[model samples]
Target: MEFYSFNKENGKQITKFNSNFVMSRIIQTDEAAHIGCMYLDKNGLVGYHQAVVPQLLLVLNGEGHVRGENDEYVRVQSGDAVFWAKGEWHETKSETGLTAIVIESDGLNPSAFMKLK
Candidate 1:
């Protein structure tokens, strides 16, 4: 699988709302959304499974490996974002540990802002 990365370092600095931070655009869903924080410890894993809806995993801390239908793992670290369409098979694992934000909805369209790596 190919890599997909989106870090705040690549985002625009916010001068309109505030001047102290950079904002990385993740997703904008018009439908109802389910957002949650996920933590994977050393040797942790989120087993291969089909996505119930359009899902976006935004890495917030540490690093990990992720795979889609091909079963090939792609390295991901802080600022990386992975998207899986509804019914797509995917898995995530980390040798060390990682923390991330997961956003799931039917209207997710990450390509609007995030570039594939």
Candidate 2:
């Protein structure tokens, strides 16, 4: 068993899509799976982008809104989970700050597992 925690003082600060956020990598495997924690400050925004791989965001604290390519926004709060499929465009914004667990993998293609023999 392994234990993990998000340490703000130690997490990597990343700026992308005009947003500033912190990420703490919990686990990353050569198999293309990644698990991490992300922190977004109040009024923080993650600009629209497409997911190269499948991704899941599990909200742990605070409130936020998620928008998809269609420009529709959905309210998200603590305990909410959102998923984005590969190549899906999405964005997020935090009105009251947000903390979330993120899981993603490049190996999530279901077509790759089809046995067409």
Candidate 3:
């Protein structure tokens, strides 16, 4: 698994048309993509399984732990993004609740836009 940042610090400030905000790019897929929000309640867990396609998990709120092929859990929180390659084993868990956006696609290539964490 690889970690990326989607925090405001990694985004581009937009001052066009009198708008003031930072835009953090996520992904662009050449193929079909599945995007969804994941809500993990306290003590919740997403069991270990091989990714059917490349996956990117973007933390939206709260904190949690993630584990990849090596089975070493790492802490993750809001603004953090985690990537797992297709066929890689991974899992997500939270002891204090967490919410995230999950993006899956065979054409995922996060490195092209996201900054490494």
Candidate 4:
């Protein structure tokens, strides 16, 4: 078993459109496994990037769009599921009235990225 935690200011470390959000790490693996929860404002946009391990994005709030990997674009909404292939370039863009959460159970720790400010 592993322990992880997150504070209100932590989510600000990773924001969308400069909106305020919160984050929490529900689980973590001894090696390099972790989960993340996030909130994005309407029309929010997350930078484009890739990861060493594939990730899954589950919409827990409103709706949005995800673009990356060979210029592929996917639309997602609450109750929708998106698969992020490992090392596949990816970015997030939200239209008006959008919010969502993401999970990266790879080699990322919430405490390492959390922003206390």
| Candidate achieving the largest lDDT | 3
lDDT of 2: 0.69
Q: What is the lDDT of residue 91 in candidate 1?
A: 97
Give the distance in Å from residue 111's predicted Cα in candidate 3 to where it truly belongs: 0.6
TM-score of each: 0.91, 0.64, 0.97, 0.56
TM-score of 4: 0.56
Compare the candidates by TM-score and give the number of the best one: 3
lDDT of 2 by residue, 47-105 (tens): 89998787767678998999777867888877566767888899989988999988788
Candidate 2's C-alpha runs over 4 A off are 1-31, 107-117
For candidate 2, give the lDDT of residue 38.
Answer: 91
* TM-score of candidate 3 against the unseen true structure: 0.97
lDDT of 1 by residue, 2-117 (tens): 34567866677888855777777777878999999999999999999999998999999999999999967888999888888899999999999999999899998888877776
Q: In model 4, what is the error at residue 20, expressed in angstroms?
A: 35
Candidate 1 positional error at 55, Å? 0.5
Comparing 1 and 3 on TM-score, the stronger one? 3
Better of 1 and 2 by TM-score: 1
